[model samples]
Target: MSWKKTSITIVMGNDKYPKGTRTATFNNIVPDPTEKQIKSFAEGLQLLSDGDTYLGSEVIKHDQLSAE
Candidate 1:
């Protein structure tokens, strides 16, 4: 068998989380995330996680926030 390599990166925010804090939104017991919502959330997370000491912003699609 041939050897393979993979890389994974994890970044943490500065906020202090409780010891037992865990994500429950993705447990499937609640409503699934829409494609637009997922994309928006991912972009927001990436912006916050980026270590660069510069301010960055982007406009999200209005429909993503609307309940329609």
Candidate 2:
């Protein structure tokens, strides 16, 4: 398997969590994340998790050659 670089955004929500810290993974990737990506590409990543719910996901960074 090859390595793919992507800036995914994961927004979590629950009654116990507040709006300030609701966002699990903001915009940008782990290496160097900028602000937040309001328009996510994917969601529902934490269906198996507990109270943490996946609001959305966005792949800002990716390899164009991976398509081939």
TM-scores, in order shown? 0.30, 0.40
lDDT of each: 0.35, 0.50
The sequence of per-residue lDDT tens digits that candidate 2 reaches over residues 1-68 is: 34356555566666676563365444435543444433322233444556565555444665455556
Cα misplacement distance, residue 20 of candidate 1 (Å): 26
Q: Which stretches of candidate 1 lie over 4 Å from their true place?
A: 1-30, 51-68
Model 1 Cα lDDT, one tens digit per residue, 1-68 = 22232222222333344542222122222133454655555466658653322122223221223345
Off by over 4 Å in 2: 1-4, 26-49, 62-68
Q: RMSD, each candidate, Å?
A: 16.4, 9.4
- Count clashes in each candidate, considering only residues at least 3 apart in sequence or on different chains: 0, 3
Model 2 CA lDDT for position 58: 44
